[model samples]
Target: MLTYYMPPKTMWSNLSKETLRIYLDQAQQAYNDLLIGNKPISVSYSQETGAKSVTYTQANLQQLQGYILELQRTLGINRRRAMRIRFR
Candidate 1:
């Protein structure tokens, strides 16, 4: 028999269930930027102030991905979505 030790609730008490999903979505968009067939995530446009701006969502891609992975592990969130696909 195998037994898994569950972490105390306090360890993950502050982690939101939606945190990983939100980050995953943002990160996926960023990840696709490098794919040949997929559309890029970055865009250039002007703000209301008429200033040119570049919108590159991937700027925090690394940080988002890291937090997502960490929250997934800490919250055991991946175990429940083994074959689930969610779109928003």
Candidate 2:
């Protein structure tokens, strides 16, 4: 049983690159699991200046994929390949 906790968006900026990468990897794994018909538990947390709140959501492919993309963007990871042309 795999459980994934989504850190608050505010926390993302405070996270180190390695931490973001870990989250990205976990999100991708959860996305793949959902594709294979497995529903993992997804927990989310929200924090205010003086209050903290927690919410639970059913794992969905799209959400996980979106999170992964967000993490990649934060990490400056570009997946697209550049095409090169050679002039003789």
Candidate 3:
């Protein structure tokens, strides 16, 4: 007779199915928020290689907030959730 069997338990087995599902859902949402909401806009810029070279821009709080707002609207996610992913 064949002795085909499954593997031993894993760490994830410690968590209830419902709890694991919720955690997975939250994690997926957080990742989606990051992809859609985290964008860097030009808050400042300076030329390092003279005017003929490409410009380098700085990112700051103001540009981050503006982009977050735009992303929230576009993604249909709440401001808090977007901010959580950004700050986390």
Candidate 4:
């Protein structure tokens, strides 16, 4: 008999659910840019503006990996439907 082991929740507690959501959002943006064949998108910040803004294709790979993991959390039915809808 084989025993499967799952890691403790504390290992992931450092990253809140909201953080995953934010990373997923960024991944979607990067994918959209990739679809449009855009490269090296610009990211800018301003002290007076109190915010940063830009449009480009550069994305954090670690964040994207996390987003992929998030997508993997979904079931097969929903994942299949999403893939079909997204491509068409």
Tens-place lDDT per residue, model 2, 24-80, is 776666666667766654534233344333222353556666777877766767645
What shift in Å separates residue 81 of candidate 3 from its native position after superposition? Answer: 36
Q: Model 3, range 49-72, lDDT digits (tens) per residue?
A: 332222112334443444434433
For model 4, the run of ten residues with the poorest summed lDDT: 74-83
Per-candidate Cα lDDT values, in order, are 0.50, 0.60, 0.39, 0.47
**Candidate 1: 10-residue stretch with minimal lDDT:** 39-48
- The numbered model that scores best in lDDT is 2
How many clashing residue pairs are found in candidate 1? 0
Off by over 4 Å in 3: 1-8, 38-88
Better of 1 and 4 by lDDT: 1
| TM-score list, all predictions | 0.34, 0.55, 0.33, 0.37
TM-score for model 3? Answer: 0.33
Q: After superposition, how far is residue 6 of candidate 4 from its true place, in Å?
A: 9.4
lDDT of 1: 0.50
Clashes of each: 0, 0, 0, 2
Candidate 1 residues 1-49, lDDT tens each?
9867564464334546575355446545555663434433543323244
